[model samples]
Target: MPKLLLAGAGHAHMAVMAAIPELVAKGHQVTAIGPGERHYYSGMGPGMLGGTYQPEEISFPVRDMVESRGGVFIQDKVARIDPARHVVILDSGHEEPYDVLSCNLGSFVPQGVVACDNQDGANGPGAAVASRSVFPAKPIEQLWKARQRVHELTRDHSIRVGVCGGGPAALEIAGNAWSAGRENGGNGCVVQLFTGGKLLRNMPERVCRLAGKVLRKRGIEVVEGSYVRSVQSGEIHLENGKRYVQDVIFLALGVRPSPVFRASGLEVSEDGGLLVDQCLQSLSHPDIFGGGDCITFVPRPLDKVGVYAVRQNPVLLHNLQAHLEGRSLKAFDPGGAYLLIFNIGGGQGILYKSGVAFGGRAPFWIKDFIDRKFIKKFLPNAPSETH
Candidate 1:
């Protein structure tokens, strides 16, 4: 029997984790490893921060989904991989050998790039995340803490909020945090977004124009062309030596793949993502397959978006089972233009698709509808009520 080991319970691995029963019935041994029992859907995470959805509504019980279906679930993380030995090294110093290994190890915020203000490194970086005022958006759960922190700080007085980066995540975080602050009795709370360049520069021009209009209308200041040098609790330091005081800071910088791939000495992309072909198999190690943000698809590079990861689910499953059974593998088609929606808080959103972009309450509803449906598909027990 082939031993199939799955690393990280992320979006691309959701289907694989849910199919543990069938894999076991087919005489395959499966084991899944992750850091959390629940895998939160990042698409709705900003909404959660804005008080539109509760935490439980946006996360899947990945560990329970695996263990209850005849697969072993290890509540740990993959520290490194020894491809030559066909072994996975756990952070706890344990080794798990596998005949075939799949990685859905998602991307991470480049926090290390920003120097922490705390010189002693005390109560930061390596410390508890919730206890800190600075937050990264990639973890998804950090947004929850940001909301709570806004609530807590706003109790005393209106607080200034700073959001770094100019990407979609930065926009959503800035917008959502604005709405979250009001719920905590914050009056005249200011939200300043330091874009470091043209706002939403990677997106379509229409998206950029519409997004800027919405943000400006809501009193959120957009600081363009000012790159961030570092961050400290309650402060933002721009590269030009300008400093602004803030009660909360959200680090929504561009995401980079986990250092595991590059650290393992495997083939990697310029961004340190595992290098893979059209089949999503690592170029240097045939037995090692990966999807999502962790992989740089060589046929054509894909953006670090959840939609592409969701689209890769079925193709990855098919290829993995086929490879294990000595059958022919299939190629992954990235599909055509996908629907892009940004929840800009206050029950408003901007929708873009097929080169067309629009903004309104209808767009927000459309995004909410689609995101909830995705959760319903995986977790039928999830609540359907909107916030």
Candidate 2:
């Protein structure tokens, strides 16, 4: 039996966790490592920010889920990977050897935008300033905690909230933050969304118009056609020489791939994501596999979205088992046009796919049903599946 080591409890890895029993029965030893015990479902992120769901409601306890299936779970981050020796080095200096390894480590916000000094003159005077007030909307937990900070700060005075990025996450954050403020006695709070390009660029123009309408209705100032050049204390400077006053900033900027693979000499995309073949196996090292946002499928590059990751779960599992049993591996096909539902807060959502867009209460219910169904599959007794 080969030792299978799963790195990171990301969306695809959640499938592996749920199938641990079957994998164990097939004579494979499974070990999983991640930085935290819980994995937050990104789909419900907007809901959480809007006070529609609690932290526990959207998070899955990865440790308990894996351990219940007779697999070992390590709550630590991967510091490095020694591909030559097939060993994973932990931040604490421990090493674990494996016969096969799969990584689904999620990406992070670009460090350049978030790395600021904690003290005076940390990044030098007049340089881009980053303080505790800046928050990145990735890794999920940090964003959840940032919401608490926003609530606390808004308890006394109205603050200007800035959100960067043009993707669905950014739109959702802006709406949710505005809703959060209004519901929490900060009705006069101001919200600004800065996007380098048009908002919801990936979606159809109709969807974009709907999103714009919703944001306008919520009084979110959408600054388009320019990106943020730098952020300083109490203000954000745009590339177009425009300045916006902000007390707190939330970055919904897209993620960059983890550097662990690139540092290990693995074949990686220009963005530093692991390059994988059709079988989801590493192009440079076949013994290694990767999925989710950490990998770029060479033949058909996919957008860094959770829907693709969720779809890859079954393919990854099939290939892993095939490799162990010397059977033919299956290729993953990311078909064009998957359903994208954006939760716009207040029991409303927008649905877009294949250039058709619609918004109504029905889309919100659909999104809620789909999200709850996904959570229930991996989580036991998941709050009776309510919309």
Candidate 3:
């Protein structure tokens, strides 16, 4: 039996772990490595922010799941990968050998956007001064800390929050902030959402408009058609040189592929994503496989959303098993028209898919049900609650 090294306990990897029993039965030893006890479902993240679901409801025990499969779960980050030597170096200075490697290591939020100049002039004299206010919304713990910091900062005083992104997460954060503020003390806090392009650019215009409307109706200010050039202590500089004051700024501009893999000497795309072929195998190495946000299939443009990773699980599993057995590989194609539901806080959601849009509490309920179902299926049961 060949030993498989699975790096990153991300959504894709978690899905693969849920089916690890079959893989183990097929004569393969799977070793999972990631630095987390729980895997939080991104779909329920918005609901979590909206206070619709508790944090525990969104996260499942990955440590427990891998143990159930009788597989080794090393809760450590892969510091480096040596493709030629077929070795993965861990952060703790341990090394592991792999017969085959599958990378679902997820991705990192772009440092360029987060560390970009904050022209607010509050931090320093320079006009292009970078703000220390960046909050990278990956690795789960960082985002959790950010939320905690925001809550602590806003507890005693009226706060003005600015979210820097037009994506679903930004909208969800803005909505969550507004709803939380309203519940605590309406008008005392202000939630502002700023976007570089129209919100949800890939989605239909009508859908974006409806989303904008729903946000506006909730008293959340939506700023569109502009990029935040820089941010200062209490001000945000727009690309047009206009400045808006903000007490708190969220650097949720966008997410990019993980830089760790690129640092490993793999062939990455121009956009910094792992270059993978149709079968989701790395172009540079035949023994390695990759999927999730870090990979890009140029022939078919797909969203870096979690759904695509989830959909790719079966194919990844099949192709992985076949590759190990020296059988023919199968091709996996991502379909068009991704179904998206954006949580607008206050127990409401805006559904958008294939140019149609729907917004209501019913969608939120459906989303909640779906999210719970997913968590129930993939979450590995833990021995005890440590968190």
lDDT values for all models = 0.86, 0.83, 0.74
> How well is each residue in 349-378 modelled by candidate 1, as lDDT tens digits?
999999889998999999999988887776
Which scores higher on lDDT, 1 or 2? 1
Structure candidate 1, residue pairs in collision: none
Candidate 2, residues 250-319: lDDT per residue as tens digits?
8887888888998888999999999999989999998899888899899987988889888888888877
- TM-score of every model versus the real structure: 0.94, 0.93, 0.88
For candidate 3, the 10 contiguous residues with the lowest summed lDDT are: 121-130
Give me the overall lDDT of model 3.
Answer: 0.74
Better model by lDDT: candidate 2 vs candidate 3: 2
- C-alpha RMSD (angstroms) for model 1: 3.6
RMSD of each: 3.6, 3.4, 4.6
Off by over 4 Å in 2: 115-117, 124-130, 380-387
How far in Å is the alpha carbon of 366 misplaced in model 1? 1.2
